[model samples]
Target: MFRFEDNKCYRMPAHFGGFDCPGPEAALYYKDAVSVTFTYTTDEKQLASYVPEGFELLRPELNISYSQFREIDWMAGGAYNLVQVSVPARFNGKRDQLEGQFILVVWENKTWPILGGREETGIPKIYADIEDLHTIQPNYYTSASYEGNTFLRLELLGAKPVNGQLLSEMQASAATINALGWRYIPKVGAPGADLSQPILYPQGAEVHSAWAGSGTVKWTQLSWEQNPGQWHIIKALAELPMLEMAPVIMAKGVIILKPNNGRVLE
Candidate 1:
């Protein structure tokens, strides 16, 4: 149970579950977001092992992004930062249409967003220290690190506004690129039940945003440690040969968490 008194709210143990947790307690908005996309080639067989049976790898491309928020609803929201890694993929053997980029991992500095995202969408959200600091005019630098190990470093030079045509294209792409996740349900021991086959649910999210831009992207991956069980595939990606890096596509946007209505493949 929860109670609001004297302009403050308190949460009890009973108020848990049922999507009744306190908050978004705050809303977030960002004006300037720096994102960098890195496209690299990897072994097809290795890539295929990570996803579901029918899902297909669209391309050997990987995108890593870093952004610092300009506005946050909370009082202590001082330049919150985020870093994410994703790969372009298609679902159900549909090579003609891009299902969207599947998020491999995500790191952020805040707690509420991470908790909410993990619970709702099954996105692997972890806590880390991310900094987007400005050392020189017209040039911004960013880095993401965890437990004294720096994994990502980037430098954006000569930031500028995106063109109208490119911005519109980006918005359209953002709308179509839904967030995908893998949900697992273990089998229960019941009478005459099929215990060998577990349940898997493919989840998706509605993505909506109106802002995007581009800049010269100079990025480097310092380390890729296998800290969690689900993210062990990152080690294989780190072993792949370094291919050309794509121009950074930056966007300040919002991701709407909708109920899981996506197709469930048995």
Candidate 2:
């Protein structure tokens, strides 16, 4: 006989004992992280089309970021890279109205985080080979690909360190980072979802250092034969017009991912 515990987190192969569940306040530490972020203004209508019904597009700005995470506590001192694409938005639910960044897509080099994130937190995660952040002093570069076919590339140039006062100001402004996601679990052998809802994933970062710079991004128009399953996604993103470029930033910090603090939104 088997009994499920309310506090436990379970995934595939349920026959095996489920993994340990961290406390809600427990910190998932990401040490020695370096990230390059590029934000730019895009076509409002085009970006709005991707946002779901219950969400309101806050702006036409799109954010693309790449990071190399080292010595993650949950990964047991392992490392991984990821590319995250998001936009400013607000979630208007029956009982909850929240303003935050809504995730469009996340591509990770490893499968372990992808599985846990998608299944539990409802993050729209997929697999891609994210190259390590290549740096040559003031310049940094990285790219994402599948089966040797590159779909996206990001670069940061002439990055200069920002003073502590400015860093603190920036940190204070973004102290509460609410990441919104949509969880949709398809019914077994069906066209509809067994469970579909919006989720709130809270996170934070403690910046030890930071840099501000100019950035550029190139989104390849992936063909069906090249990306197969993800061609449409890449194509849509590729068509977004980068009407204006915003200031880019590079930061070295410790990221706190509070998965246990995650919850379903109205």
Best by TM-score: 2
lDDT (Cα atoms) of all candidates against the true structure = 0.53, 0.89
Kindly list the per-residue Cα lDDT of model 1 for residues 97-125, writing each as its tens digit.
33666666788888776765655445667
lDDT of 2 by residue, 140-230 (tens): 8889999999999999989999986899987775556899989999999879999899999998788778899898899987788888989
Cα error of candidate 1 at position 28, Å: 8.4
RMSD of each: 7.5, 1.4
Candidate 2, residue 179: lDDT: 92
Q: Candidate 2, after superposition: displacement of residue 218 in Å?
A: 0.5
Candidate 2: clashing pairs of residues = none
